[model samples]
Target chain A: MKRKEQKTFIAAFLLPPLLLYALFVLWPAVNAFRYSLTRWDGLGSATWVGLYNFRNILARSSEFMPALEHNVFLMVVPGIITLSLALFFAYVIHQRIRGARLFRIAFFFPNIISSVAVALLWVLIYSASDVGLLNNLLRLINPKHEMIAFAESSRLLWALVPMIVWSGTGFYMVLFLAAMENIPDSFYEAARLDGAGSFALFRKVTLPLMWDVLTTGIIFLVIGGLKIFDVIWVMENGRPTTTTHTMATLMYSKVFEEYNIGYGTAIAVLLFILVLLATMVSFRLLRRERLEY
Target chain B: MQRMLGGAGSGLKYAILVLYLLAVVFPMVWVLYTSAKSTQEIYQNPFGLPAAVTAPSAKTLETPIENFEKAWVGSHFSSYFVNSVKLVSISLVLILLLGAMAAYVLARFEFRGKGLVYYLFLSGLLIPMQLILIPLFFQFSDMGEALTRLLGPITERLGLGYLTVSLHDSHPGLILIYVAASLPFTVFVLTSFFRTLPGELREAAMIDGASEYRIFFSVMMPLGKPGLVTVAIFNFLGLWNEYLFGLVFLNSDHLKTLPLGLASISMQAQYKSDFGLLFAGLVIAMVPTLLVYMFLQERLTKGITVGALKG
Candidate 1:
């Protein structure tokens, strides 16, 4: 193909997507930015408020700060925990042990199930009364003093943490496992011949090599942690005085419950900005080229 | 003594692994078990197995199947199912085709505004669905009007008004929206794999007088199966659990997908507190996604490992 022909072909190839993307994605994002500046109930012409929407959310709304805290909590805590557990288990399975495939499948099963289902299941296990599975089990073992309502308490984090780890660790594990699996066999064999034991091999060869994959997993978890909506949405809808409210859930509440579209959009806009900043930082920190074997 | 301690530590690792797996798997197991039990049995002793090998007897099982039957027989899941499958399938195909083509252009060619073109795609990477969703809804709702103002006049003259297209609330609406929503990850993943392909092969094909379209279809696409299948399965699963978009875009009960349908039922049953029926609905909603994961775990793993970077 000549240069002009190649240019023509490229333009033809790109035009449809570019056009659709502009109409659907870029245009709408622009609309959302405009919406963030206005007070629009679904029924009316939106009233322009400029930055009042941002001001009120930053200052007044009861849901805003708690939700921001939960998102940041998710960012700092489960974000790290999930990645660590995923890497550890991926390393374990990468040891070429028997039933490694089973472990991989078992761990990944939770990510496949909807958060609504997982939250509901944990609601059963963490039920507040003797009727719940955990309480019932506790009764059998210890004749417990009191049944705990895990989802409804301030200490809901304890309950939420397990589910967060359970559901997420698997998906990330598969990435690390895939990366670890792709590690040439020669690397391990060389380490073994050098009299390095399993722990030494992991600390030196495995950890360093899987760094890019591990970093990728952390980046995913950080951004996912920030915008987590459904899991919290499903699990009591940020109940118990908004203790479990993530940034996304708080945004939902402001829009749906309080009928504050402007405030909600502001929250949404802030979340979009936060996600962008975090991803960029993670990329900069983690973008070293993967060392080829 | 040291060896025994080491053996014990190894044993502890297995125990921990088994326990974690059990913790996650048990809830799914318990829900299925209870679905076979009567409503009274659930409240009476959920931890225990059925007193006998019981079925969905009133004494043993509890399902809103009767309620669902009323909804479906009156409203019909057939339309909902057809609508859902049509929406998901059409959108999946569109994303795969356009995304792969665009990715090939980006990956293979060096051109003016390359960085801008690439960032335009990359910008979609960090965008939260909810962030862009509200505006996309406004745009799509007025999509027909927008088209008319832009190209609809020309198409009007061309008599392709016979092909008047607005995929909103209808099956095609769901398809169009999903295609747009899923485009970024698909483009990103396809580009990653596309970049890995040897450009020399395409050049050699060019020397043989093969058209770009022919090279794309006959060569690039065939060899890009891993990336293509990866995106297809992913777009399928992502669209499947999709609740917010389905809820907002498709307004009719008859056209609601299983996730949306279950959500509608559960929301109504909220005050009734019908835990048994709700669990059953949750179980029902989960089965299709679970089956996909079971069958296509490899594809899912591949897709997400690439999509993970978009994070």
Candidate 2:
């Protein structure tokens, strides 16, 4: 192809996606920041507030603080359990345990289901009705057991832990397992030859080699916890109270429901900043001398 | 004594593993079996085998069919299923083609502003969808008005009826977003993938008088199959299960996707105490992705592993 033709081809191939992305993704993202600085109902002309929305969100006893607390709770509580369980499962399955394939396949089944479906499945499990699985079990154990509404707004944050852990463990397991598999068998052999037990070998060898992927997994969990919306939306039936709202849900309700576009977009901007800071902070905190195997 | 203790330890390990396996599998099995029962039967016996399975009477056998019929037709799950299929497939095709085109150019060619373009796409990874969502909502409205203004005169002059082009509540509007939003990661992954491909093939094809376009279409894209498959699967799963975008963009019940449909049905079903319809709807929402996962478990896992390591 001629040089000009080559240039034409490049332009032709690149421009479509570039223009689309710029218009849809980049343009809107840039506009989000500008919109954050103004107070406007979505349909009306805007007036500049000059950080008033952010100030309100950052104020003492604001709704943002409790919602932010829920986000942290979601992140930390499930984050710890999911990571620990994933590591354990990855380690065990890596040891060539019996029915390893069955365990791996079955475990990952939940991860493939949509978050809405998973939330509904858990809602059924936690339902306070005769059809509720937990209530039924309780009744079987003791006839006098009163039904408990496990998914009510007040207890919803805590209830999400088991659901999150159940659905998330498999993905991280596969991630850590792949990293574990990449560790040359010779490292484990060397550790064993030096009188290290299985536990010691795992602690010293396997853990160190997979540390980078583990850090990546942690970042994923944090970001996922921060951006959690679908499950909460479904479980709350689209009316998440202040108690159950994460930043994402709050932003949605603020903009779409209450028409608080400025406040909502401000929350979105804060969320973007939070996600950015979380990713960077995680990298900084988890950064170690990269061990090249 | 030590050996005996080890045996007990391994026994306990197996026990734990088995317990977890049950925990994971049992709920899915429960949903499956419970869908076969009527709502009344479900309330009476949430855990037992449905009479459809245990007794297989002519009258009892109709329950599963009725549940599915209610979900599929009585509710709007059929339209939702079709809508999901149409939207996801169209979005996936466009994402793959456009992503591959841009990725191919960025990967193989050396040009000015290449770094700038690459970094532009890379910057998108940091911008969460939440940030863009509100603006996009308004942008769609603005764009709709702008297009209406642009097209109104032309249509009026051509003796056609007055025309207004609105992207709101349409599949094309959402497709544009899905494709555009998906391009960043698609290009990032495929750029590296294309970089790893042997340059000799391109040279050989060029020496044989093939054009750049021909080389790309014939030689590069074919060899890019594995990478394409990986990207395809990831994007397929993401777009298929996407909810937030659908929730914002689509409002009509008939236009709603599987996730949206499932969510709405779940709320209504719970309120109406129609557990059978909810269970059946859940199955409809779940079965396709479950089938895909079952078939492509190895590739799916490998894709995530590669993506994690790379990220």
Candidate 3:
């Protein structure tokens, strides 16, 4: 192709997507910074409030602070359980135990469903009435046992622990399993030849070789934990209070529901910063020298 | 003694895996059963199977299928399902075409500001899209009027009356947002995929006087089918299940997607003792994705691993 034609072709190819992306994505992203500085409801004129939104957000008593705390709690509490269980399952599956394929598929089934649907499933499972599985089980175990309102906003975060872990563990397990599959069988053979027990072999051979993917998995968990909204939103029936709010939920309710455009944009900005910082910190904290085979 | 110990260890591993599997599937099984039961039956025997013969009446016997029918027709999930299908299909096509074109350019060309453009696309992956939610809403609100004004004259000249296009609370509005949000990751993946394809074929096509567009469409895109399919499936699954964008942009009842529709029913069911309908709605919402995942498990899993493990 001639130079002019080639340039035209390139422009033809790149311009459409780049234009749409910039208009919808990049422009709004940049505009979010400006929106953060103004106190405006979405419908009305935005005023120059400077840093007041940020100030209120950072104050101890603001809903944003507690929301952040909930996010952090989710990050730490579920993070550890999810990673550990995922690694365990991945390792077990790697061992080629009987029915491993069935377990893998069964576990991953939930990951394929919509987050909203998953939340609804959990809402049923935790329903305070007779339809609740947990409550029914409780009633069976003790005839007079009162049904627990597990889906209520006050208990919503704790209720999320199982739902998050259940839906999440399988993906990470499969990720690590894929990475494990790539590790040459000779390495495990060598470890066994060296008299390494199964536990010792895993710790020595499996974990080190799978470290890179595991780090990626952890980073994914962190990002996902911070961005959690749909589950909480659906579970709380789209009315999450401060106790159950994560950053994403808070941003949604504030801006969309309350029309606090400036405050919500400020939350969005902080959420972006938090996700970036968390990703960076996770990479830094989990960084290890690459193990070349 | 060593054999016994190994047997015990294996037993323990099996137990854990089985326990986890049961934990994973029990909720789905329970919901499925509950969807088949009446509210009275559910309250009376939450764990029991739906009665083999309910009141010996043909009308009330098939509560299982009836609940699903109610959810599909009565709760209006059928429209939501259609809406989700439309949104996902349109967005996936646009995302693939635009993403492939952009990825093809980035992979093959050495243009001015090439690195800058590539990084600009990559940066979209890191910035949590929730950050732009408010601005996005504002932009859509602004564009609603702007588009109407821009198109009004043309429509008037064409004798079609005033043409109005609102980006808020419309299908196209949500489609634009979904395509944009999914673009960064799609581009990043497809670029790397395109780079991996052998350059000899493209060079061969080039030497034969094929135009750049021809080479891209005929030589490259067909060759990049696997990558395109992977990206397509990933985008389909993500955009199909997307909640936030739809929640914010879709205000009308008819435009609600499956997740939104299901959410509304569940919320209403919280007050009303309509767990059967809620369970049925959950099934309606879940079945398509579930079936797709079951059939295309390898591709879906590959798509996920590629995004995460490729660094």
Per-residue error at A261 for model 3, in Å? 1.4
TM-score of each: 0.86, 0.98, 0.97
TM-score of 2: 0.98
Candidate 1: where are CA atoms >4 Å away?
A: A1-8, A42-48, A128-131, A143-147, A153-157, A185-197, A237-241, A257-259, A285-293, B1-6, B51-83, B144-171, B199-210, B309-311
lDDT of 3 by residue, A52-132 (tens): 999988874568878888988887788899889888888888777667788888887787788998888888889888888
Q: Quote the positional error of residue B226 for candidate 1 in Å.
A: 1.7
CA RMSD for every model? 4.3, 1.8, 2.0
Q: How many Å off is the CA of B91 in candidate 2?
A: 0.6
Number of the top-ranking candidate, with TM-score as the measure: 2
lDDT of 2 by residue, A207-261 (tens): 9888889899999999998899999999999999989999999999999988999
Candidate 2 backbone collisions, by pair:
none
Best by lDDT: 2
Ranking by TM-score: 2, 3, 1
lDDT of 1 at A105: 82
* Candidate 2 residue lDDT tens string, B1-311: 12122567688878878898888888888899999999999988889999999999999999999999999999989999999999989999899899999999999899999999999999998889999999999999999999999999899899996789989999999999999999999999999999999999989988999998899899989999998998888888788889999999999898999999999998888889999999999888889988898899999989877765665
Q: Report backbone clashes per prediction.
A: 6, 0, 0
Best by DockQ: 3
Tens-digit per-residue lDDT, A15-63, candidate 1 = 8887777667777777778889999875568899999988888888676
